[model samples]
Target: MSGNDILVTDGLSKRFGDFSAVSDVSLRIQRGTIHALIGPNGAGKTTCFNMLTKFIAPSSGRITFNDRDITAMRPADVARLGLVRSFQISAVFPHLTALENVRIALQRKRGDSFDFWRSKSALEPLNLRALELLDSVGLTSFAYSKAGEISYGRKRALEFATTLAVEPEMMLLDEPMAGMGHEDIDRIAELIRHVSANRTILMVEHNLQVVANLSHRITVLTRGRVLAEGDYRTVSENDEVREAYMGAGHA
Candidate 1:
């Protein structure tokens, strides 16, 4: 692995009985770069994210984060080590106000999430951090709005803010732009670029244009294996990628 690599996988594989979901997938993500994974549906991209984040155990292989072996670590442990993931679906609390949701996440990061007896004013620092997160994601104007009342795009943005409360070193984003309108997509693309400036971002996305625009490097997967790995031009021009897309009727 390169000295600057923040995340690495060697011979990673996952199987459900006789069916292999991911096979011998080795990948390296450099620090402070946006690395994108692109493929057709059911290409095992989500499975790979689950294994890397320790949400699911790999059938075989190894994972390293910050140069430490973490293949078998629990999800919380992995998260605590500064590797955080944002789900494709929003994980925000719909009933809570946007500010409250972020405040809760910040409290969790501070290990005070279970301190329910304390009044809101007592946790001044946590509340301040939560506001900072909301401002960072451009949601401060909606701080008092119920999370469920926000636009779908803004809710997704709120999710990103919650993830930032943990101050991760690296992020695994699953379809960050999913279901967004054109304007929202542009906004999110900008937000992603802003966030990626300080940390490594590894994302799985179906939008080729977004991937081409944002990713410094691209890894194309097919049939649970890597078909190509390189820059936008290289992957776009690759024969294997062309074949994969053509077979999926997306070409």
Candidate 2:
């Protein structure tokens, strides 16, 4: 792995019985860059992402992060090393207010369990940082609202705030634009761009326009293998990519 690369995968493959989901894939994600994994439906994008995050074990391969082999690490162990998947820590409490939810996450990061029996005053120290996180994601105005009462877009913003509380060095976002209207998509996209200013981001998204606009590098997968890897313009112009998307009845 290059000095600039924060994450690397070698000969990564996954199989279910006789079917291969991801095959001999390798990747080098550079530090502080937005790298996207995109492909048509059933192209193993989710399976590959699951393996990278350690949500599911790979059939065969090696994964290294920050120069340490983490292929066998548990999801929480990998997350503790500063590589976190968004929804992994975004178990937002519906009954809690926005501020409370983020504060709980901050407590978790500090190796403190949320003390439900303790007085609210005890959590005051974490409030400032939690509020800052909420503000960063444009959720400060809703800080006192119950998380379940917020709009879907704002709920997603809440998720971002909670994720930020963990202080992940690299964030893996899966289908961040899924099930969103145009305005929500734009909001989340800007939030992503803002937060990525200081950390590396890897995302799997089907929205080609969002991928083109946000990704510094794009990896295209087709039928369990890498078809291309490059910037938006280069990958967009590749004949194989064109065939994989256009010829296979994908847009």
lDDT scores in order: 0.88, 0.88
What C-alpha root-mean-square deviation, in Å, does candidate 1 show against the real structure?
A: 1.7
Q: What is the lDDT of candidate 1?
A: 0.88
lDDT of 2: 0.88
Q: What is the C-alpha lDDT profile of model 2 across 44-111, one tens digit per residue?
A: 98899999999999999999999999999999899999998865223568899999999977887557
Per-model TM-score on C-alpha atoms: 0.94, 0.93
Give lDDT tens digits, candidate 1, residues 110-169.
674666787778667777778888999999899999999999999988998988888899
- As for candidate 2, its clashing pairs are none
Stretches of model 2 off by over 4 angstroms after superposition: 88-91, 114-120, 246-251
* Lowest summed lDDT window (length 10), candidate 2: 84-93
